[model samples]
Target: MLQKFQVNLMASKLLWTIFMGLLIPTSYSVFFNTTTLLEWSLFSISSTPIMLTLILDPLGLMFSCSVLMISANVLKFSTIYMKEDKFINRFTVLVLMFVLSMNMLIFLPHLMMLLLGWDGLGIVSFILVIYYQNPKSLAAGMITALTNRIGDVMLLLAIAWTLNQGHWNILHMWMLDENMYQVLTITLAAMTKSAQMPFSSWLPAAMAAPTPVSALVHSSTLVTAGVFLLIRFYPFMSSAWWFTPLLLLTAVSTTLMAGLSATTECDMKKIIALSTLSQLGMMMAAMGMGMVHLAYFHMITHALFKALLFVCAGSFIHSHMHSQDLRWMGNLANQMPATSSCLVMANLALCGFPFMSGFYSKDMIVEASMFYQHNLLMVTLMLVAMGLTSFYSTRFSLCVVWGTNNCNPYIYLEESNPLTSPMLTLASMSVISGAIIMWVAPLKQEMMLIPMYQKLMPLILVLLGASLAWLISATKQKNESMLMQTQINHYASCMMWFLIPLSSQFPMKLPMYLSHNYLKLMDQSWLEALSGQGINSLSVKSSNILMSASKPMPVNYLMMSSMLGLMIMMVMF
Candidate 1:
């Protein structure tokens, strides 16, 4: 009966989510012509009014709708995925909290309110990441939380800097010159959340969480928080002279780095995660080009397909008894046709196949880059990153779905309703979201009379990448020796160019060394001796001397009695 009640409760929650998901888009369409900015003053800090303001602009509504739709699907999916867990209730609550936090982040324009959502995401995500209670999960959770905390601290710093303007609402303070520090710090904060180059390791490591969490938090909502923040802050950042170049450099580097890493990754989820990193870099690059609308479009479309990909991968992993290594997966198209089909569609979308969701935004981003007089190196890197995205995605599909059947015959692959339902929804969105988003949020590109080569650059690079992937796949079967021969290259690619190890080692090592040397040596030894132990010893010694001095001494008592008598006589006189 209790179990039945739990099931019913979960179903009701899912129904409510679906209702909200459907309601948002409908309401958004009806109110499409209107832009509403609502603010309620929460309190005053000194003389500055800290307000909770919500902006219902087209962008915010679209993103909020996407978050809700995806979240609803994730919740429904989790009901089945987490059915057997004893702590399903706790998990459900956390997922709901995550959803709510993302909603807060999406709608709220105030930095203070945004921080509430931002910190909520960080804390909730940390709990979710470490839900498994293993060492790897714990470590991953620590890294995820700590990395996000850096972003959180930066947000706080931005808030502190914003206080100089005597307002917490970012929209009111549009003058860029006054808030350059705040803008820069906020961008840096967003970079950490989005898992840009230096902070990229945690995204892959965070795969230690449950697949449902991965599908919801890492893939769709949480990771995109940074992009969303940047999209909102685009106006302020536009006038900053140094912001664009710095962002472009970082985004392009991250794009290339993550693409290379994905190609060598063996873990199925991590490959997808790295691909996400690469796509985010692309989005950031687009933003750097001052194409905020285009970046927003890509973000929405990417969320749909990326979530779908993660869900399909989760199903695959669950069927394979939680084995996530792609080497162990092959010919799944024959075994799990429905799931494999979804995987293929998601992959094709990711590769930016023609007319697909990814293509709509990705093609535009490339074209827009060409239209703008960008640095040649930047343009080349962007194009190469696109190709590498296709290459790794194709490589992944070949190994996991279409290659030889590598699993044992005895292993059973289940295709249940709960597993396929959410994926089907996402797959449908992956197919059509590009057109829907483009139609809704139409971005006008300048008609630049560029050469055919310039316009066809993205498609050409994609084909090249596809061909290379095929060649590599074909060669891999014939001669495993090739990879063995190029040991150095293999290691570098596998280690993500040593970025992972360096990020992991340096942050931990330096802090630990400082803690041991400074904390233990100075704080524990010297400070403790002087302030704690030494002070206690001195007090004890002083007490002992005072005790000895006052220990019923006849002279001392007589002197005290005589002084008291003399004082009493003086008072009487």
Candidate 2:
């Protein structure tokens, strides 16, 4: 019965994948051939006058199509990746729920309705992050859920503040007065979900989840939620003075931090997770620069290759008896040819190698940054981040694909169709999606005359980064002193400069300390003494005293004396 159920579930997912494949072309038509906005009203509350509105435009259509496409592939991958687990059916349901939530977020335009989907994503992600039922998974789930909850709170506040405008639908409120607080709140909320600086610990910690979950959540659905929200809310924010510089700072910091951390990470999954963070930063940076379309384009391309990277990494883990440490992974190109090839392709795309998926969007973002008159420091940081991206991608490739083979002799290292199939599908997209998006949804670039070197700055950075990585990889094997120094330097990088520990600890400890004090001083001492145990003890002591006093008097004698006194009193009256 169990086997039959699993088979049926897999079939359902496969059908969904086919449906999504068809929907992609439909989405392309809607994006390029149609300009009409579709809307439907679910219901409206007359009291507070909040309307639940669903709006589908080209942007939403594009995002929805991407979500469905990636989701279908993830579900298909899960069928094989999670086949050995006892609760595979439950996992499938959670993934489908996650997809549904993302769809709701994509399709809905009302702040009230979007909240439903936003909150759903947060709650469902928490459940999925903790799906493994272990301490680490539980801790990660807490971080993931709590970090996202901050965003949820911000959205709720935005919704509440916007109630004064008498409409919950942001699309309908074009002329509504823009509130800086609301916009800032929403932007910060988006930052939290995107795992920007100060809230980035949860992204890597969330790798405790199963890899298929990682592939889905980190790549297309969960992390992108913030970027999508910003894209939708961009109109209201474009003119805000603080919006650009704030977003620029957050994005550049997150990009640099994540890239540096990725370079030092030895855990294969964490490296991929940090790379996702870095890419998300790029997307956010583009949005910050007032290029929503470019950010959206990069977002779609990143989703394709990042998901492929996670699936490939997952395959490696499964083959290597669940070990994710990169030190144990080496020369996989020989043993697992298909998986290794996919890894290389994804890494190359991540590094923004010429003409690849990342190049099409990332190159434009770099160029756009240069074309704008921005702060020199911010631009330099962005360029350095581009370099670090290539540096880390090459480092990861060297460690996992071409390093020494360290697997146990008896362990089988072979790629299965279930794993490689989804990877190949995504790899194909990784090759072509960039070009297609550029052709179909091209961003209008400003005409500027500049030196050839400026146009090729991103490529130049890539070469410099790749060369640095090669030098490090080549020399580390021969130089013990250099390796030691590298390790010393890596201490800060590997610990993410204590960002995770400090963020996790401060938030966790402050609340815990307050709770402990509340428990000890209020619940255990004051409240108990005044309301609960103290009152009970006082009543019990009073009753005991009354009983002891009454026992000293005889009932009959007391009654007779009382009667005599009553008669004397009546005569006197």
Candidate 3:
């Protein structure tokens, strides 16, 4: 009966997930109309509205919607994706955990609950990352998990700082604080969680997981956790003088770095992986500039387009016997029409093509940046990032979909096979999802613009980027070099590394470097040394010291005599 209950609980969780996605929206329609009842959950018990908040704020609504939709879709995909895998039960459990955590995260009001959700999300992601449990994949998962844990620590410090300042209940109340320590800690937490700067390396490594895992977790949900955190804590971030500039610096560095790295990547997944980071950096920049809504709006659209891109890439890989190298892939449009079409649509969204969901959010961010102080430089850097974004997105789509027909000699030796109908279905949804996002209201704010041409700047950047990409690719088609490719792949890293020398001038540089590399090594070494000598050393030293200061123990007869003497004395008393 207990075993049955566990089964029931697990099954019910999935049903709850479906309800959270579909039934909640239906419930909203009803609750807004005829229902006088207010259904309270843990979320309600914690949430206190001090500002002009909707019954459900737009950010929460959009995020919850995305959470349900993608999770449901991922569940559908995973039913097949994990079919042959031995760890299916564990996979399902983690997926359920991820869904539950993400839902709670969107609705969480206090910092404590938000941290709980954040850690839960991290655990689920780590489990998903190492699902197969191979050495390389486990290493990848551990690195990401460890890095995220570091971010969590900084976040905890920030929370303590906030509570000390008497911002006890409302974590979102940022401007109320005048503390600089709180500001630095929070900024550090955000940048690390978002995988900005040196922390960005783990994301590409995370592509070692399954394709569905990559699509939903890395591309859409997990990688966006930091960005979402920024959106949630936007009020607090703006209160800090150092916050915006730091955020902007990280954003630009990451954007440029990821773009350059995307160029050199051979694995299809890593290219998309780097691209996700680049796009996320841009979103972070927008958030730092006080465009909270715009940041989340882009995050939503990015989830749609980037997820589709990954699913499509997965289909491409599955079709060709799990080959992830784009260089070996060519002329797939003729063979995998569904996938090609979907790739094209997602690319359009990614390139910020006009009327697409990508265009809407990207424009809002750019507009926010324009309104930002020092608009010219920020906008230019963003525009440059935009160009890189377009170039990489286009390159990713085109190389796999319509590049040269000739397969590499190495690939031909392996004799790759074509994809199946299931793969085609996966690709189909990715394409259709992009179109679906256009109808999502918060992101489709084109009508709210001040003037038609006011929005033209972002469009112009998109055009310039696309045109330059076309020109570069065209030139490359004449003579593509492996050297150029190598440089392009390492472009993001080079930029990040460039910061290391500059960072050397700061007082914290040595500690940061040691913490990043040597501290963990020393920690393990210390543990080993202590463990090896601990028991023997304690036994020898304590026993010798005690013996030197004490007499030998009395025999059993002496103990008996002492007891008799005590009894006699008691009798006398």
The candidate that wins on TM-score is 2
Task: Please write out the lDDT profile of model 3 over residues 127-238, one tens digit for every residue.
Answer: 8888777998997788778778878898788777765544333343646445677667766776766788867767877888888778878655677777777776667667
Compared with the true structure, all predictions reach lDDT values of 0.84, 0.83, 0.67
Question: Mind giving the per-residue lDDT tens digits that candidate 1 earns over 1-573?
Answer: 444456424643664666576566546653554578888988897989978798877777777777777877777777666677888877877887898898889888899888989999999999999999999999999999988999999999998988888987767766546778887898899999999978888999999999889988766688999998888887777778888888899999999998887877788989888999999999999988888888888998999999999888988888887899888889988899999999999998998899889999999899988887888899899999999998888888888889887877788898888788888999999999899766755465555677898888888888898888888778667312233348787787777778878888766897888778998789878898878597678757855675577867788768666765786588579
What TM value does model 1 have? 0.88
Whichever of 2 and 3 has more TM-score, that candidate is: 2
lDDT assessment of candidate 1: 0.84
Window of ten residues with lowest summed lDDT in model 1: 476-485
Off by over 4 Å in 3: 1-56, 165-168, 171-178, 371-373, 406-455, 477-573
In model 2, the clashing pairs are none
TM-score of each: 0.88, 0.89, 0.74
Worst 10 residues of 3 by lDDT: 411-420
Candidate 2 residues 159-229, lDDT tens each? Answer: 88887777777665543355878888998899899999889999999999999899989999999999999
| TM-score (C-alpha, index-matched) for candidate 3 | 0.74
